[model samples]
Target: MVIRSRRLSKDNTYYALKQKIIDSELEPNQAVNEENLAALLGVSRTPLREAIQRLENEDFLVRQPNGRLRVASVTIKEVEEVFLIRSMLEGYIARSAAKHATDKDILHLTTMMERIKHSFQLGDKQDFVSYGFEFHDYLSEISELRTFEKVLNQLRDHSLRYCRYVSMHGDWNTQADEEHNYILQMIADKNEDGAEKAMRDHILSSLSTALARIKGMEENEIDHIGP
Candidate 1:
């Protein structure tokens, strides 16, 4: 494949590679072949190596003792850790949203949630997952706090790996829609405590659901291994 590296400076390359990891194109636990990725990105090995190193430092990639780079797996334990932190950060943001969200912002959020709801009803799993993620992101935007925004983005980036593999095929999207809408209403009404609880519960609920799914898959894998 011809890789186009145009318009990519150092910062862009690093983030692009980072996003690719999140997108699962460069899937979890997969090796990172520097020479090939450099060719693929149409850049020299130097910039690619730099990006890889950055990803490594960020815990997004792991350099094996043999000097091979691998995508970091999102383990069940890691998922719990990430969401625990995210719940706290976003719980505060939701409280802030309740205190600060304007009618216009709530209206926009309602519209976006409805659009995602429609996509879910239409059985567009990819769209459902995408919208689910974007919905939380929009809520962070509602907080109007730059620090929260940055931290939230990092949290989102960490969770996004599982998102690519996350099945949006269930009725979960509808549940998510209901949850987000409730959160939005609380924020609009400036019910700070309600908003915080709703958002925190939502995060915990989803994480539980995801963990269950991962556990089920693991069980299936073990069953297969036995045969």
Candidate 2:
């Protein structure tokens, strides 16, 4: 099983690097030194290159003018484009979830929502984002649409850094909490149309906030995204 072990190692390395990018530890447009990253991750060049290649295919890393790799930067146009598609996908998922979700699912989401609300009040944006994702993940899971779930997960991961960035700049937490509560209510009431509409509205609202943040940022100022 040596080969299998190596495959697992490569996958682990890939996800670790991807998470670093997503969390902005490796900031947008920041240079990537292969040797340094290999040393830091404690992996050899071969596996590191393999992981890097995968990230390149995913657009997480891009070749720069100086022929070095850097984390991909965000754009207002891309944010709007991604969120528009997300609105449609998540709206469909909410519709299906409202028709299929059980009491257990509802209760779990409600509890998670309460935790999210509490975290928001404490100004813990990180935990708030985490719980917010968990809430959406649960709804996606209950929808039982594997293809839709997979695509939505990828889209969410791509947009999460931007989402967190804009969220930290304003009172998005309070507004998002209210919107989430309304969505949850729609799901609980089994109002498929309402659930769909609520989910789309919520995503569109976040997109509005993200677009504002993107507009305010200077191209060189993206690295300073966090509070």
Candidate 3:
């Protein structure tokens, strides 16, 4: 029982730290103080070190030249790599969804679309993104490819940091909504090719905008890689 409790505590510490990095609460390239974090989390150094090691293994944190751990910073190379992979995989998943989705699945996606639109109207960017994830998850689930869904879940989370970055600097929400509408329409029509194309186009377009904004920031001597 003691062993199990320690393991649970370690797992909780891992996820909490991972969430802080993912949500950009910790900020990219921000130095991590192990002692300070241990105090903040109300955990001892042992469990905190274990959790930090796990996050480092997962590429969410990196060791700097000074041997300090910092959240991994975004770069043009990473943006290109992540979006390229996501476009291909998500496109395939969208195609599979169109081919296999039932009436209920279609209705569920439609309802999610409405919720996303409402969120946008209310300027609730977080809710809009959350509902969009729900829509994607449902589509992937209906595709009946468990392995693909697992890969996509990680890819989407990493890509979301960039998505939120774009939203902060541009009017990407409406563009994404328009693209989503096209993808959803294709899925509803069971047009596998069209659905795949729409999904790929959406991802590539998003990548283009994010890259442009990053370039602009670099030119202005401001690195916008953090929240």
Candidate 4:
């Protein structure tokens, strides 16, 4: 019973800290003060340490040369790599979904896409993002590829972090709505090749938008810092 309780505590601590990092509440490259973090999270030191170690292993936290922990900073290289990999993996998933999806699955996906469209019309970026993920998640499920789904789940979380950063910039909603509709159409038509291509193109397009926004942000920061 005691061991089970401790395990639960550790799991809870890990998820709590992970959520903070994902939501940017911790912020990129922010220094972590272990004692203060424990107090802030209301967790004991042991479970907190365990959670920190887990997050570090996941690349959400980094240990500095001086042995201090900090949230990992987002980098263009990481973003490019992550989205490129996602394009490949999710492209394959989209193909699989095309090959396997039922009429019922198509109806569900169409309904979800309607919600996404409504969110876009309402200028509700948050709900648009949420419904968009639901659409992709359903594809992952219908793909029936357990291993691919597992890997994509982790990549999706990383993508979420970047999406949150750049989602407000540019004509993200317009581009996303069009791309998502195209992808959905390809899947509904059972065009496996087209679905794969559409999915890959969508992800790579997202990468382009993210890179542009990040570069613009960096340039603005440089401008602010210069004399």
Candidate 5:
């Protein structure tokens, strides 16, 4: 029981730290103080160190030359790469879903779309983002492609980080809504090619938006540092 408890503690610590990084509560490249973090997370050094090691392995944390740790920085290249991979994986999944989805799946997705739209209308960006993820996840679930789903899950946290940045700095307006609706329509129509293309286009559009925001952020930082 003691060993099991310790394992649970480590797992909890890892997830808590990961959530902070994903949510940008621990901003990119922010320095990590072991003692302070251990205290803040209400865990001992052993579990905290275990968590940090795991994050480092996942590329969510970086160890500096001086042995300090910091949250991984979000880069334009990383964003592009992640989104490109997501586009391929999700596009395939969307195609599969269109081929295999039942009527109940279609109804569930339509309901989720309504909730997403309502969240946007109410200016609830957080809920809007959450619902958007759920919408995609459900489609992936219905695809019945467990391997694709597993791989996409690995990228989801990183995708969410960039998505949050975009949501905070840009608008989630009619274009995004239209893109989602179009994807859903293709799925409902059981148009496999259309579903794949629509999903790919939607993801690539997001890449464009994220790239713009990231470039703007870089330029702003440079301006701030200039003479």
Candidate 6:
């Protein structure tokens, strides 16, 4: 369980824990005991503590009043805050990408958008969701803004669990695909203003739809982990 970290990337332990948290391999609301996790990851407590602190700063995990770390969870408020921030950042990224993206980048995004649609046709929710994640990164890369990409990457892993839950139970992939088409066209046309508005609308609409679905599922209890 050696955690071999390369010098090229950011903190290795933080990312490892982040991925595990995002993948749901580490359960939500589950307590992380430092000594155990340190042993498990084959790292000393110092680096593990450093990693946990980073996650704590990011709001991915929180220290309870009782003084232990757990995957952070809150009511619908978290959904609102995260989605609002997402709308802003996504709108900016889309607009910037329209201004900066190359033809090749647009083509790549188009290909990914098509892949998302095809994935839905195949009823592969996992794939549709995963490709959606990639599409976002592609857009961020094209925006030529490392800050936005960094912010997005931080939000995305946590968002994946929520998106997966929504896609699995929400039954609105087709609508999502339609929204993707709108965004793609806006970017392709290099309409920065239009792309920004469209992206903001899409983010709000998606959030609304997901919340509605979650509300409908109130009869049956489900854990909604939001970014």
Pairs that collide in candidate 1 are none
What candidate 1 gets wrong by more than 4 Å, as runs, is 1-7, 168-173
Candidate topping lDDT = 5
Can you write out model 4's per-residue Cα lDDT over 1-227, one digit (the tens) per residue?
99999999999999999888877788888998789899989999999999999988889999999999999998899999999999999999999999999999999999998999999898887677778888989999999989999998888877887777676554474888999999999999999999999999999998998898989988997999998
User: What's the lDDT for candidate 5?
Assistant: 0.91
Model 2: per-residue Cα lDDT at residue 182: 97
lDDT of 2 at 82: 88
lDDT of 2 at 126: 73
Q: Per-residue alpha-carbon lDDT of model 5 for 169-197, expressed as tens digits?
A: 76776777788899999999999999999
Worst 10 contiguous positions by lDDT, candidate 4? 164-173
Best model number under TM-score: 5
Please report, as a residue range, the 10-residue window in candidate 5 with the lowest summed lDDT: 165-174
lDDT (C-alpha) at residue 82 in model 1: 84
Which candidate, 2 or 6, has the higher lDDT? 2
Q: What is the C-alpha RMSD of each candidate to the true structure, in Å?
A: 3.6, 3.3, 3.1, 1.6, 1.2, 4.7
Give the TM-score (vs. native) of candidate 2: 0.92
- Ten-residue stretch with the least lDDT total in model 1: 1-10
Per-residue CA lDDT of candidate 6, range 139-220, in tens?
Answer: 8888988898888777776677667666667566467888888999999999999999999998898789778866766546
Task: Report lDDT (CA) for all predictions.
Answer: 0.79, 0.87, 0.84, 0.89, 0.91, 0.79
Candidate 6: stretches off by over 4 Å: 1-10, 35-44, 145-154, 168-171, 216-219, 222-227
Each prediction's TM-score versus the true structure: 0.88, 0.92, 0.90, 0.93, 0.96, 0.79
RMSD of 2: 3.3
Which residue runs does candidate 3 get wrong by more than 4 Å?
222-227
The lDDT of model 3 is 0.84
**How many residue pairs clash in all the candidates, one count each?**
0, 0, 0, 0, 0, 0
